[model samples]
Target: AQSVAQPEDQVNVAEGNPLTVKCTYSVSGNPYLFWYVQYPNRGLQFLLKYITGDNLVKGSYGFEAEFNKSQTSFHLKKPSALVSDSALYFCAVSRNSGGGADGLTFGKGTHLIIQP
Candidate 1:
Protein backbone atom coordinates (compact mmCIF):
# COMPACT_ATOMS: atom_id res chain seq x y z
CA ALA A 1 0.00 0.00 0.00
CA GLN A 2 1.09 3.58 -0.56
CA SER A 3 1.62 5.49 2.66
CA VAL A 4 3.51 8.36 4.20
CA ALA A 5 4.92 8.56 7.69
CA GLN A 6 6.13 11.50 9.75
CA PRO A 7 8.28 10.13 12.52
CA GLU A 8 8.09 13.33 14.55
CA ASP A 9 4.88 14.36 16.22
CA GLN A 10 6.21 17.84 16.87
CA VAL A 11 9.20 20.01 16.06
CA ASN A 12 10.22 22.98 18.17
CA VAL A 13 12.62 25.57 16.90
CA ALA A 14 13.74 29.00 17.98
CA GLU A 15 12.67 31.95 15.93
CA GLY A 16 15.11 32.84 13.14
CA ASN A 17 16.70 29.40 13.29
CA PRO A 18 16.46 26.74 10.67
CA LEU A 19 13.63 24.21 10.80
CA THR A 20 12.91 20.80 9.38
CA VAL A 21 9.99 18.37 9.39
CA LYS A 22 10.74 14.84 8.38
CA CYS A 23 8.71 12.59 6.08
CA THR A 24 8.98 9.17 4.51
CA TYR A 25 6.81 7.25 2.10
CA SER A 26 6.02 3.83 0.68
CA VAL A 27 4.50 3.43 -2.74
CA SER A 28 4.41 1.25 -5.82
CA GLY A 29 6.26 2.51 -8.84
CA ASN A 30 7.26 6.20 -8.96
CA PRO A 31 5.40 8.37 -6.43
CA TYR A 32 3.89 11.81 -6.43
CA LEU A 33 4.88 13.67 -3.28
CA PHE A 34 3.30 16.71 -1.73
CA TRP A 35 3.58 18.95 1.34
CA TYR A 36 0.83 20.91 2.99
CA VAL A 37 0.47 23.35 5.87
CA GLN A 38 -2.57 23.81 8.04
CA TYR A 39 -3.33 26.63 10.41
CA PRO A 40 -5.83 26.66 13.25
CA ASN A 41 -9.22 25.59 11.96
CA ARG A 42 -8.15 26.20 8.38
CA GLY A 43 -7.86 23.72 5.55
CA LEU A 44 -4.50 22.47 4.35
CA GLN A 45 -2.72 24.81 1.95
CA PHE A 46 -0.55 23.46 -0.80
CA LEU A 47 3.16 23.83 -0.12
CA LEU A 48 5.22 21.99 -2.71
CA LYS A 49 5.26 18.84 -4.78
CA TYR A 50 7.67 16.45 -6.50
CA ILE A 51 6.20 14.84 -9.58
CA THR A 52 9.05 14.41 -11.99
CA GLY A 53 12.43 16.12 -12.39
CA ASP A 54 14.09 18.40 -9.83
CA ASN A 55 15.05 16.68 -6.61
CA LEU A 56 14.86 20.00 -4.79
CA VAL A 57 11.53 21.79 -5.04
CA LYS A 58 10.69 25.17 -3.50
CA GLY A 59 7.29 26.17 -2.29
CA SER A 60 5.27 28.94 -0.67
CA TYR A 61 6.31 30.94 2.41
CA GLY A 62 10.02 30.42 1.87
CA PHE A 63 9.69 26.69 2.27
CA GLU A 64 11.49 23.98 0.30
CA ALA A 65 11.81 20.21 0.15
CA GLU A 66 14.22 17.67 -1.26
CA PHE A 67 13.05 14.38 -2.70
CA ASN A 68 15.39 11.48 -2.02
CA LYS A 69 14.36 8.34 -3.85
CA SER A 70 17.04 6.18 -2.33
CA GLN A 71 15.84 6.95 1.17
CA THR A 72 12.20 7.29 0.11
CA SER A 73 12.07 10.54 2.01
CA PHE A 74 11.04 14.13 1.42
CA HIS A 75 11.92 16.55 4.15
CA LEU A 76 10.64 20.09 4.47
CA LYS A 77 13.09 22.83 5.34
CA LYS A 78 13.31 26.53 5.91
CA PRO A 79 16.40 28.70 6.36
CA SER A 80 14.84 30.83 9.10
CA ALA A 81 11.90 30.11 11.31
CA LEU A 82 9.32 32.65 12.39
CA VAL A 83 6.64 32.70 15.04
CA SER A 84 4.07 32.70 12.28
CA ASP A 85 5.65 29.55 10.92
CA SER A 86 4.35 27.61 13.89
CA ALA A 87 1.63 25.40 12.49
CA LEU A 88 0.72 21.88 11.54
CA TYR A 89 2.55 20.35 8.59
CA PHE A 90 1.70 17.25 6.62
CA CYS A 91 3.54 15.15 4.09
CA ALA A 92 1.54 13.28 1.50
CA VAL A 93 2.19 10.71 -1.20
CA SER A 94 0.28 9.51 -4.21
CA ARG A 95 0.93 6.37 -6.14
CA ASN A 96 -1.24 7.22 -9.09
CA SER A 97 -3.20 10.43 -9.01
CA GLY A 98 -4.16 10.79 -5.36
CA GLY A 99 -2.38 7.58 -4.52
CA GLY A 100 -5.52 5.61 -5.42
CA ALA A 101 -7.98 8.04 -3.83
CA ASP A 102 -9.36 11.30 -5.06
CA GLY A 103 -6.44 12.96 -3.27
CA LEU A 104 -3.15 12.03 -1.69
CA THR A 105 -2.59 10.11 1.50
CA PHE A 106 -1.47 12.44 4.29
CA GLY A 107 0.66 11.70 7.27
CA LYS A 108 -0.57 12.20 10.83
CA GLY A 109 1.11 15.59 10.70
CA THR A 110 3.78 17.31 12.75
CA HIS A 111 3.10 20.31 14.96
CA LEU A 112 5.79 22.92 14.48
CA ILE A 113 6.41 25.25 17.40
CA ILE A 114 8.51 28.31 16.79
CA GLN A 115 9.63 29.85 20.05
CA PRO A 116 10.62 33.44 20.08
Candidate 2:
Protein backbone atom coordinates (compact mmCIF):
# COMPACT_ATOMS: atom_id res chain seq x y z
CA ALA A 1 0.00 0.00 0.00
CA GLN A 2 1.09 3.59 -0.59
CA SER A 3 0.70 6.30 1.98
CA VAL A 4 1.74 9.87 2.74
CA ALA A 5 2.20 11.51 6.11
CA GLN A 6 2.23 15.20 6.92
CA PRO A 7 3.15 15.32 10.59
CA GLU A 8 2.53 19.01 11.03
CA ASP A 9 -0.99 20.26 11.26
CA GLN A 10 0.14 23.79 10.56
CA VAL A 11 3.31 25.64 9.71
CA ASN A 12 3.88 29.28 10.54
CA VAL A 13 6.40 31.64 9.00
CA ALA A 14 6.92 35.35 8.82
CA GLU A 15 6.48 36.97 5.46
CA GLY A 16 9.80 37.05 3.58
CA ASN A 17 11.20 34.16 5.64
CA PRO A 18 11.86 30.73 4.31
CA LEU A 19 9.14 28.12 4.80
CA THR A 20 9.09 24.36 4.94
CA VAL A 21 6.29 21.82 5.03
CA LYS A 22 7.34 18.32 5.92
CA CYS A 23 6.14 15.22 4.10
CA THR A 24 7.06 11.53 4.17
CA TYR A 25 5.78 8.66 2.08
CA SER A 26 5.76 4.88 1.89
CA VAL A 27 5.17 2.66 -1.08
CA SER A 28 5.89 -0.86 -2.22
CA GLY A 29 8.15 0.39 -4.98
CA ASN A 30 9.33 3.63 -6.54
CA PRO A 31 6.88 6.35 -5.61
CA TYR A 32 5.29 9.15 -7.60
CA LEU A 33 5.05 12.12 -5.30
CA PHE A 34 3.01 15.27 -5.74
CA TRP A 35 2.11 18.49 -3.98
CA TYR A 36 -1.15 20.34 -4.17
CA VAL A 37 -2.47 23.54 -2.66
CA GLN A 38 -6.07 24.48 -1.82
CA TYR A 39 -7.27 27.99 -1.29
CA PRO A 40 -9.98 29.08 1.10
CA ASN A 41 -12.85 27.67 -0.91
CA ARG A 42 -11.27 26.56 -4.14
CA GLY A 43 -10.32 23.08 -5.20
CA LEU A 44 -6.78 21.80 -5.05
CA GLN A 45 -4.30 23.09 -7.58
CA PHE A 46 -1.23 21.17 -8.65
CA LEU A 47 1.97 22.50 -7.19
CA LEU A 48 4.68 20.11 -8.35
CA LYS A 49 5.62 16.51 -8.71
CA TYR A 50 8.53 14.08 -8.57
CA ILE A 51 7.88 11.47 -11.20
CA THR A 52 11.50 10.95 -12.19
CA GLY A 53 14.63 12.97 -12.67
CA ASP A 54 16.72 15.21 -10.46
CA ASN A 55 16.19 14.69 -6.76
CA LEU A 56 15.51 18.39 -6.40
CA VAL A 57 12.29 19.25 -8.23
CA LYS A 58 11.11 22.80 -8.71
CA GLY A 59 7.47 23.74 -9.08
CA SER A 60 5.15 26.69 -9.42
CA TYR A 61 5.38 29.81 -7.26
CA GLY A 62 9.09 29.61 -6.53
CA PHE A 63 8.55 26.42 -4.56
CA GLU A 64 10.82 23.42 -4.64
CA ALA A 65 11.08 19.99 -3.07
CA GLU A 66 13.88 17.56 -2.47
CA PHE A 67 13.13 13.88 -2.93
CA ASN A 68 15.16 11.83 -0.46
CA LYS A 69 14.92 8.15 -1.20
CA SER A 70 16.86 7.06 1.83
CA GLN A 71 14.51 8.95 4.07
CA THR A 72 11.45 8.43 1.91
CA SER A 73 10.73 12.09 2.30
CA PHE A 74 9.79 14.95 -0.01
CA HIS A 75 9.80 18.15 1.95
CA LEU A 76 8.43 21.28 0.28
CA LYS A 77 10.46 24.46 0.61
CA LYS A 78 10.29 28.06 -0.43
CA PRO A 79 13.06 30.59 -0.07
CA SER A 80 10.68 33.31 1.00
CA ALA A 81 7.16 33.18 2.33
CA LEU A 82 4.29 35.40 1.25
CA VAL A 83 0.83 36.02 2.60
CA SER A 84 -0.56 34.74 -0.65
CA ASP A 85 1.24 31.47 -0.07
CA SER A 86 -0.80 30.73 2.98
CA ALA A 87 -3.04 27.82 2.17
CA LEU A 88 -3.70 24.16 2.79
CA TYR A 89 -1.02 21.99 1.28
CA PHE A 90 -1.31 18.28 0.73
CA CYS A 91 1.25 15.62 -0.10
CA ALA A 92 0.26 12.63 -2.17
CA VAL A 93 1.93 9.42 -3.31
CA SER A 94 1.30 6.65 -5.78
CA ARG A 95 3.28 3.50 -6.35
CA ASN A 96 5.11 3.42 -9.64
CA SER A 97 5.00 -0.37 -9.67
CA GLY A 98 1.62 -0.16 -11.42
CA GLY A 99 -1.66 -0.51 -9.68
CA GLY A 100 -5.05 -0.06 -11.31
CA ALA A 101 -5.34 3.57 -12.41
CA ASP A 102 -6.75 4.56 -9.07
CA GLY A 103 -6.45 7.81 -7.23
CA LEU A 104 -3.42 8.80 -5.20
CA THR A 105 -3.08 8.46 -1.46
CA PHE A 106 -2.99 11.85 0.19
CA GLY A 107 -1.92 13.14 3.54
CA LYS A 108 -4.31 14.95 5.80
CA GLY A 109 -2.92 18.40 4.94
CA THR A 110 -0.74 21.15 6.34
CA HIS A 111 -2.10 24.59 6.85
CA LEU A 112 0.57 27.16 6.00
CA ILE A 113 0.30 30.48 7.78
CA ILE A 114 2.46 33.35 6.65
CA GLN A 115 2.32 36.29 9.00
CA PRO A 116 2.92 39.73 7.62
Candidate 3:
Protein backbone atom coordinates (compact mmCIF):
# COMPACT_ATOMS: atom_id res chain seq x y z
CA ALA A 1 0.00 0.00 0.00
CA GLN A 2 1.06 3.62 -0.61
CA SER A 3 0.60 6.30 1.98
CA VAL A 4 1.80 9.74 3.07
CA ALA A 5 2.06 11.32 6.50
CA GLN A 6 1.91 14.98 7.53
CA PRO A 7 3.08 14.82 11.11
CA GLU A 8 1.90 18.23 12.20
CA ASP A 9 -1.78 18.76 12.81
CA GLN A 10 -1.31 22.50 12.67
CA VAL A 11 1.51 24.86 11.77
CA ASN A 12 1.58 28.47 12.85
CA VAL A 13 3.76 31.06 11.21
CA ALA A 14 3.93 34.81 11.32
CA GLU A 15 3.50 36.82 8.19
CA GLY A 16 6.71 37.27 6.23
CA ASN A 17 8.36 34.36 8.01
CA PRO A 18 9.52 31.22 6.32
CA LEU A 19 7.29 28.20 6.66
CA THR A 20 7.44 24.49 6.09
CA VAL A 21 5.00 21.63 6.06
CA LYS A 22 6.53 18.21 6.31
CA CYS A 23 5.51 15.12 4.39
CA THR A 24 6.88 11.58 4.29
CA TYR A 25 5.67 8.84 1.99
CA SER A 26 5.86 5.07 1.72
CA VAL A 27 5.14 3.15 -1.44
CA SER A 28 5.73 -0.18 -3.07
CA GLY A 29 7.30 1.26 -6.19
CA ASN A 30 8.42 4.63 -7.39
CA PRO A 31 6.07 7.23 -5.98
CA TYR A 32 4.10 10.10 -7.40
CA LEU A 33 3.73 12.69 -4.70
CA PHE A 34 1.44 15.72 -4.62
CA TRP A 35 0.50 18.57 -2.38
CA TYR A 36 -2.89 20.26 -2.26
CA VAL A 37 -4.31 23.15 -0.32
CA GLN A 38 -7.93 23.84 0.55
CA TYR A 39 -9.46 27.04 1.72
CA PRO A 40 -12.77 27.55 3.47
CA ASN A 41 -15.61 26.24 1.29
CA ARG A 42 -13.25 25.92 -1.65
CA GLY A 43 -11.94 23.02 -3.66
CA LEU A 44 -8.51 21.55 -3.28
CA GLN A 45 -5.92 23.54 -5.20
CA PHE A 46 -2.86 21.85 -6.62
CA LEU A 47 0.27 23.18 -5.02
CA LEU A 48 3.03 20.99 -6.37
CA LYS A 49 3.93 17.50 -7.52
CA TYR A 50 6.98 15.27 -7.66
CA ILE A 51 6.88 12.77 -10.47
CA THR A 52 10.32 12.57 -12.05
CA GLY A 53 13.40 14.50 -13.04
CA ASP A 54 13.95 17.39 -10.69
CA ASN A 55 14.32 16.96 -6.95
CA LEU A 56 13.04 20.46 -6.29
CA VAL A 57 9.88 21.68 -7.99
CA LYS A 58 8.28 25.09 -7.60
CA GLY A 59 4.56 25.64 -7.70
CA SER A 60 1.96 28.37 -7.43
CA TYR A 61 2.12 31.06 -4.76
CA GLY A 62 5.86 30.90 -4.22
CA PHE A 63 5.60 27.36 -2.90
CA GLU A 64 8.20 24.72 -3.55
CA ALA A 65 9.02 21.17 -2.52
CA GLU A 66 12.05 18.94 -2.57
CA PHE A 67 11.83 15.26 -3.30
CA ASN A 68 14.28 13.52 -1.00
CA LYS A 69 14.79 9.97 -2.19
CA SER A 70 16.96 8.96 0.74
CA GLN A 71 14.50 10.09 3.37
CA THR A 72 11.37 9.44 1.31
CA SER A 73 10.22 12.90 2.17
CA PHE A 74 8.78 15.84 0.20
CA HIS A 75 8.51 18.79 2.49
CA LEU A 76 6.80 21.99 1.26
CA LYS A 77 8.50 25.32 1.84
CA LYS A 78 7.86 29.01 1.26
CA PRO A 79 10.23 31.90 1.79
CA SER A 80 7.64 34.18 3.29
CA ALA A 81 4.17 33.24 4.41
CA LEU A 82 1.13 35.47 4.13
CA VAL A 83 -2.12 35.60 6.02
CA SER A 84 -3.85 34.43 2.89
CA ASP A 85 -1.62 31.40 2.96
CA SER A 86 -3.52 30.11 5.92
CA ALA A 87 -5.27 26.96 4.77
CA LEU A 88 -5.45 23.22 5.10
CA TYR A 89 -2.57 21.49 3.37
CA PHE A 90 -2.50 17.84 2.40
CA CYS A 91 0.20 15.52 1.20
CA ALA A 92 -0.72 12.61 -1.03
CA VAL A 93 1.04 9.82 -2.84
CA SER A 94 0.38 6.98 -5.26
CA ARG A 95 2.28 4.28 -7.04
CA ASN A 96 3.89 5.20 -10.32
CA SER A 97 1.22 5.49 -12.97
CA GLY A 98 0.92 2.40 -15.13
CA GLY A 99 -2.75 2.63 -16.06
CA GLY A 100 -3.33 0.71 -12.86
CA ALA A 101 -6.34 1.11 -10.61
CA ASP A 102 -4.45 2.58 -7.68
CA GLY A 103 -5.78 5.73 -6.05
CA LEU A 104 -4.02 8.40 -4.07
CA THR A 105 -3.62 7.97 -0.32
CA PHE A 106 -3.95 11.37 1.34
CA GLY A 107 -2.44 12.46 4.61
CA LYS A 108 -4.43 14.00 7.39
CA GLY A 109 -4.32 17.64 6.41
CA THR A 110 -2.33 20.13 8.43
CA HIS A 111 -3.92 23.48 9.10
CA LEU A 112 -1.41 26.24 8.40
CA ILE A 113 -2.28 29.28 10.40
CA ILE A 114 -0.42 32.38 9.38
CA GLN A 115 -0.55 35.03 12.05
CA PRO A 116 -0.49 38.53 10.72
* Whole-model lDDT values for every prediction: 0.94, 0.94, 0.93
Order of models, best TM-score first: 2, 1, 3
**Segments in model 2 whose C-alpha atoms lie over 4 Å from true places:** 95-100
Q: Estimate each model's TM-score.
A: 0.94, 0.95, 0.93
Error of 3 at 101 (Å): 6.3
Q: Which residue pairs show backbone clashes in model 3?
A: none
Give per-residue CA lDDT, model 1, range 10-113, as digits (tens): 99999999999999999998988999999999999999999999999999999999999999999999999999999999999875754456467899999999
Which residue runs of candidate 3 sit more than 4 Å off their true CA positions? 95-97, 100-102
Candidate 2 residue lDDT tens string, 68-101 = 9999999999999999999999999975545678
Q: By TM-score, how accurate is candidate 1? A: 0.94
- Global CA lDDT computed for model 1: 0.94
lDDT of 3 by residue, 14-109 (tens): 999999999999987788899999999998999998889999999999999999999999999999999999999999997555677657889999
Q: How many residue pairs clash in each candidate?
A: 1, 0, 0
Best by TM-score: 2
Pairs clashing within candidate 1: 95-99
